[model samples]
Target: MSPAASKRQADLLKQEGNAFFQKERISAAIDAYTGAITLCPNVAVYWTNRALCYKKRNEWTKVEEDCRTAIQLENHSVKAHYMLGLALVNRQKLSEGIKALEKSLELGRGAHPASYMVEAIWQQLSKAKYIEWESLSRERATQLRKLKVACKEAICNYNSLGNPAADAPEEQLNELEEVFKKAAKTDTPTEVPDHLCCKITLDIFRDPVITPSGITYERAALFGHLHMVGKFDPVTREALEPHQLVPNLAIKEAVDSFLSEHGWAYKIR
Candidate 1:
């Protein structure tokens, strides 16, 4: 096929995909996007659109892959990054997801602040000194609900069913709300003590800026949290450890690898 004909076909597929998406026909939309990608794989938008469709369809893995491809084709694509971030966030890949969303913001999409929703929940509630978690925005509350449930699931999967916090019973979720009020912010505040319950206090899961200091970005973030509300648990503490936790290491490495692979300069220190 001629280049012009391929471009025209790709455009048509994209248009049909958009129309189907607007009608809430996720599968059809995906099919159209797939067609577009097949016709002109060079255009990042085709992959990006398909990513969104997969996201709406709850095809989280596909969403991540498509968005990653889109970003590779157009590194400045805020929408693509945002969509990828949401997919990761929903899958509880909080560290990596937040990193993508933050990149989207840096690329000029502030309204896409939805990336920070999860951390914000536990952080903010901790700051208020009350457990009025039900008052969160609908979407945010839903994410938290999911997070709570996921924590519960994790605990159950690990055979630690007795820990009510991990299980997140209503009373426990509510009771934990008060920690936010007394939290502090620090770039390197201490990690959560092994015996203490883990949680974010104060709605400040805001990303911490990493400079030339010996601290990792996540450590800086933990410190920022400490400065804001002075509270944390095992979950937050893993960031600064010499051998960062699995999820944190994965994300930190992903960013560095992504940048390095693309010939962009970034340093951990």
Candidate 2:
């Protein structure tokens, strides 16, 4: 076959693969994508499509391999990079995944379809980074508590003695305060999880309430929004009434438990 004929055949195969994928016939989709790749070995789309099929099967290794192959064939393949990033993340290689996702975003430049993928990558990266920072913060807090206890013991021992260490405890406390201020400045601010935040106010929910549309929102915020803007779901734009709102006890309990565990996250603001 001529090169053009070969490429056309590959394109037809890819379309067949897409149809199968849409129908959730993942095995058939993979077979069609494999046929396309065999016909046009250099085509990045075929490799990426096969990678997507592997992803549906939760086969991270195969997804990563196929995505890498696609990337090698076409350096600027956004789908290839995005898929590789997801595969790496699934394999617990977070930093590598983040880098690949960032590269995909840079290459795509907020293009349609890929823009949504880029946004998802950003959210996952942000969540992972936040969890890492939270762990570090807890460790630092524990160390600081230990140091404070040691300082208190030292102060008590000095007071028991005849030695005049009048200003020493105060000075030590001032120094510790300075250290804490510096640490706070250096540390990343705690982030409220998206699920815990109210859609209307964008703050951590004190009392989550579910609307008839099955979307959760903070009670007061949603009530105020309903009163002001007329009864409607902010997210789904579903027609709703104030009476349709119901308390979401499950989400409220989750928020309470999270706050209790991560007290530092419960800022006054």
Q: Cα lDDT of all candidates, in order?
A: 0.57, 0.77
lDDT of 1 at 186: 16
TM-score of each: 0.44, 0.58
Q: Stretches of candidate 2 above 4 Å error? A: 110-115, 135-178, 181-269
Per-residue CA lDDT of candidate 2, range 1-269, in tens? 99999999999999999999999999999999999999999989899999999999999999999999999999888889988988987887767886887777667643532234545555565454455456677788788778877877786678668577466667766876777667555444456688888877687775577887788987667767777887778999988887787878899789767754554344423
Question: In model 1, what lDDT does residue 174 have?
Answer: 52
lDDT of 1 by residue, 1-269 (tens): 99899999999999999999999998999999999899898899999999988888788999999999998899878778777877777676666776776666556423332244334432322322111211323345466557666755554565444654454455444544443223211111233322121123321123322323323334334545545654432343423322222223443455444433322211221
In candidate 2, the residue pairs with backbone N, CA or C atoms under 3 Å apart (3 or more residues apart, or in different chains) clash, namely none
Global fold similarity of model 1 (TM-score): 0.44
Number of backbone collisions per candidate: 27, 0
